[model samples]
Target: MRVLRKRMDKPAHLGGVLRDALKASSLDVDLDLYRLWEQWTDLVGPVIAQNARPAAIKGKLLLVNVSSAPWMQQLQYLKSEMMEKLNSALEREAVKDIRFKIGPIE
Candidate 1:
């Protein structure tokens, strides 16, 4: 049993460890995205909830739906400024753009 334990501890068998590290990194990315989505939506909720719904995409952009053309136009004007504020708040460049769409609402 002692010899078997020594063999099992060999550093040459680190392939499994490498795979686990990759998996953990992937999971970390997923969790980060989820948290950013939750935080950003919550941050912008009151401002846009009545006028839009937003989703985070690829950690680089936010897709928003506006119920009216006027709001869409307004949002377009503030896009970059909003992105800067959001990225600053998130402490990372989590969003580089905001895409607006017309919502299916009267």
Candidate 2:
């Protein structure tokens, strides 16, 4: 007589598997940070998205490029709110603070 081996009956979702791998590598936060560029318009509003865009990430700080000085100044007031929205979007606290600079939005 022989014993049968146990095995998973179903396969894991590709997305879920990739996410798990990234998490294990500690790159999940970086992925979320980079996602901001594409999801900026959805995370924030179209108006704000038009004026500013996520540029880079340095540790927990997010760097954003604003179209103009006024826009940069305006973003200062919304930094905390944006950070909250970003963290919410990523489903984790990936961003601790936001820094804005006057630069091309395109």
Candidate 3:
């Protein structure tokens, strides 16, 4: 006697599968961080945004580039507040800390 076997269906689009994989591996957080960089101006005020640029995200720490040493120093002082604002805006603890560096903003 022969037995019948059931077959699994495949996703219509690869996009969904890839997105699911990314979420499963927690890579979606990195994408969210990229989005945060794009919306930096809106998240922080124009003044601070103009002087600073979100360079990268490593784990829970965010690296920011400031146009001048003064701005970098200022940002160092405001790091905690910035983290609070960013995490609150994201509705998650995406950013636990921020590091400010004196570099080219653009």
RMSD of each: 7.6, 6.3, 5.8
Cα lDDT for residue 73, model 2?
A: 88
Query: lDDT for every model?
Result: 0.67, 0.86, 0.83
Model 1 CA deviation exceeding 4 Å by range: 1-37, 40-42, 104-106
**Which residue pairs of candidate 2 clash?**
none
Angstrom error at residue 67, model 2 = 0.6
Off by over 4 Å in 3: 1-20, 24-26
Q: Please, what are the lDDT tens digits per residue for candidate 1 over residues 27-105?
A: 6446545665566556565566578666435446676678889989988998887777667766777677889999752
Query: Which regions in candidate 2 have their CA more than 4 angstroms from the true location?
Result: 1-30
lDDT of 3 by residue, 1-106 (tens): 9998877596457898897898677577778677888788888899998999988888788888899988988888888888888988777898888888887777
Q: Model 1: how large is the Cα RMSD against the reference?
A: 7.6
TM-score against truth, every candidate = 0.56, 0.73, 0.73
Q: Which residue window of length 10 is worst by lDDT in model 2? A: 25-34
